[model samples]
Target: MAQIAVDSSPKKKNFLRSPYMLTIALLPIILAAWWLATTVTKSVPAILLPTPESVWIAFPRVLGADGFGDQVLRTLTEIAGGFALGASVGFFLGVLLSSSSRLRAAYLPFLSALEAIPTVILAPIIIAWIGFGIEGKILQAAIACFYAVFITTLSGLGLAEPNAVALMKSLRASKWQTMVKLRIPTALPVIFGGLQLGATTAIIGAIVSEFIGATGGLGYLMLRYRSSFDTAAYWVIIFLFLVIGLVVYLTIWYIEKRFVFWRRIEVTRPDLEKQ
Candidate 1:
């Protein structure tokens, strides 16, 4: 009897044998490390780095504390408001700048300088001027969001081939029509790249602003925990930040993938991946 043959011509082998399972496995490894240092080995002091169990216990108490819900609501509101305001202004400014060489040259340097300023310093002054309320926090997030979106939008629109624009002009397409029908769609992927950066930057801006002077917010909670030396509660706040940042990042990533379905996107650094 003839034996069956199998074709195993070279194809892309996954970097890991069991990608999903391996990813999940890392969680246990991290947890074990935390447990070993805090519990078994007792190498890390509890006050500085509380045990995982203590953090877990602190979560409910923190969530149930008075005004906790309001604090969370305020932070979320600031993020939403700031992101929307900044992204919109950035997009329009990008369009205007892209249309005018003189304007782009005149203002881009100033924008870049603003972007270079540290959020910690920028936030405090903005908070003071805007009066230590939600307005300042929103403005802080907006500034961070604006620069990322502005830079990306400008680059993305410019990515449109010169020949493509000439071809549109040959067909007697007006500038507005050319933009709507040709440029915007071409720029989506790159614009979304800006938005992905904006998402996290917005969060950073809001939190940093809250740190300057605020009666409520996750940052305020974190400050209170620090003052009291409540390591477990502080860890809980840290975890909340991690979760929020991850959610915002993942949300942008998902949207990017959804809209740019024609091309594949990778979350991992492209430099590390094999060609």
Candidate 2:
């Protein structure tokens, strides 16, 4: 019998497979490309695309010296208030509509039509009615968030397995009990999807409202900087907006991971088997 040779080389880890690692790895490449484009090649004008160093310098100054903290706080307040109002109303309305086919048929089309209209167009009208205050901003954010949440939630509720629902009914389960124990769990992932989309939309809405007319906020700051041709400062403000949007999305994602554990299990099980 021939002796078999045993290979004992350790498996190399693949960092690129990790999402966080991939993001980290891409940052330097992106920065280098931006720097090269602006500085070396001059493909983009410095006025429009400021140097990365200039933008980096502007970041700390904006945070400390330029009162950007107050602007960020104000914008966050508007987003929080708007998201709360919109999500609560959307969830309840979705539940009501899902409970009745006739109601869904009557209202869903109208809701879709309203969603089709750009929310930014309403910014001027909202500002006109409510003035350049936080109220109008909140309203704008809420309107932007509402439809996505409502439609997604309605669809999620409708996805409940009919056989499972029938089984629950045969066991004499109360409507509320069935909803709480079965329908809600089934719909959570989809509802969370809507919430995630709504979160980003709410931020956009707030910023657009600020752009139209606002006493303060990042959008107002961005407009000010742009008007003054301070491209570096404008980029800093844009970075802050990106950070805020990321924070909102990640917060929603964390909540989903905590509550929607079943979905996580379902997704991970296949990957685990492959491993």
Candidate 3:
């Protein structure tokens, strides 16, 4: 009998397939295009679209004497507070609604109506009632987040497998146990999906509130810069806003990846020997 030898080899990583690499690659092209538009061709007026170097130079001034750092901190704090309040209320309400059909039927219409009204419209009223401070901004963010979280959470809870519920019931599991052991875990993916949307909406709400009325925040900073026609500083502030939004989104994405591990796709590497 002849013996056959098997070879095992590691596959080479495809650098171009990496999402991070692709994103990083795109940045230089975007910057070049922006530079060409602003500097070379001068298609857009300098007053409107300042060069990248101007924005870069404005960063230190914006961060230092302009108090841009403080404004960022203020906005972040408002987002955090509002998100916490909204998430708490939404989660509890969703649980209540899911557990009680009668309550769900009675209150869902009202909740939907509230959600239908644009959150930006409420910003003025909130500012007037609570004053142009972090509190009002927080309330606006909370209101913006509330509806999305509530609706998604309710939908998630409803989507829990009926067979699992029946099994829990047959096992004499208490309502609380059923929720903790079955419903919540089942609903986590959808709930996190809602949370992602809520985080974005919360940021938008805070900014809108600040735009309506605020002593300090990025939105207010943008308004001040726009009025002065200091386009460089305006772009810098816009960049900071983008950073903040990216951070919020990435944070939630990280949480989802960690806690919702079961939903992650499994990547299998092919065996070179088999091939």
Candidate 4:
């Protein structure tokens, strides 16, 4: 007699599928699904749930007609400035703490505590103190970004194998030589991790601070749309934010590829298997 059996677990499939390509393919399907649902139900009004076409048409109008272009440009400028400042500070501190045990021990706890504090809550106080300008935004972004890089650098530096250190010492390598040749190279992966985290948070910090007080930005645009109950415009602003975040993320990813070529052999082995 044959026995019936069921396979309960899902099989793991190929990992070579590009998430980017999948997303692009799925976007139109999503829009179609949304359009059908709204049209069939008619439960929600068009004003409240404007179709994708409406959003597309309205998007360009915001460029000049409503000062959307200028707002976006200003916001991008602020984000770039803030991210640069944060990344610089984070990288420096990371290197410092990695090299100095005393500094890491003394400051790691403080850094952890600072990270626990809610950045959103700090926005009002920062605005009050710094008067709602670029300085406040820059400071906020820098602080948010600092700990990630610091910890990553610390861990990466620590990851230097003892044998490697011993070999360097036996070779009478100078402190600078040891650091440049061995410690720093071993820590590159961790440093890159910190950099990616810092870069993403920098964008978040700038946008959040702008939400608290600013006359420009995608965040500010979101605020205005919220006040007037223009959900469509709010959605558009949100989409723009997603795009900006993606851009920053890709930038960091590109940097990682440039710096961590050694990791690629391992990372892309799945592609080899698929092919």
lDDT of each: 0.86, 0.87, 0.86, 0.77
lDDT of 3 by residue, 1-275 (tens): 55433322244577776678988999999999999999889898979799988999998988886566788889999999999989878988999999999999999999999998998789888877879989999989999998888988999988777788999999999999998899888888899988989988998888888888899998999899889999999998888878988998999999998998755432132333244
Candidate 1, residues 62-112: lDDT per residue as tens digits?
Answer: 999999999999999999899999999999998889888999889999989
RMSD (Å) of each candidate, 1 decimal = 6.3, 6.2, 5.7, 8.4
| Residue 134 accuracy (lDDT) in model 1 | 88
Per-model TM values vs. the true structure: 0.87, 0.89, 0.89, 0.83
Better of 3 and 4 by TM-score: 3
What local lDDT score does residue 257 receive in model 4, on the 0 to 100 scale? 76
The parts of candidate 3 lying over 4 Å away from their true place are 1-15, 265-275
lDDT of 2 by residue, 1-275 (tens): 56432322234666666579978988999999999999889999989899898898888777886576888889999998888888888888898898889998999899889988887799999988989989999999999998889988888987778888999999999988888888878999999999999998999888998998899988888899899998999999888888988988899999998998667656645745365
**Candidate 4 residue spans exceeding 4 A from truth:** 1-19, 44-50, 266-275
Candidate 2's C-alpha runs over 4 A off are 1-17, 268-275
Indicate which candidate wins on TM-score: 2
Q: Candidates ranked by lDDT, best first?
A: 2, 3, 1, 4
- Candidate 4: the clashing residue pairs are none
Give residue 122's lDDT in candidate 1 (0 to 100): 86
Query: Among all windows of ten consecutive residues in candidate 4, which has the lowest summed lDDT?
Result: 3-12
Which window of ten consecutive residues has the lowest lDDT sum in model 2? Answer: 2-11
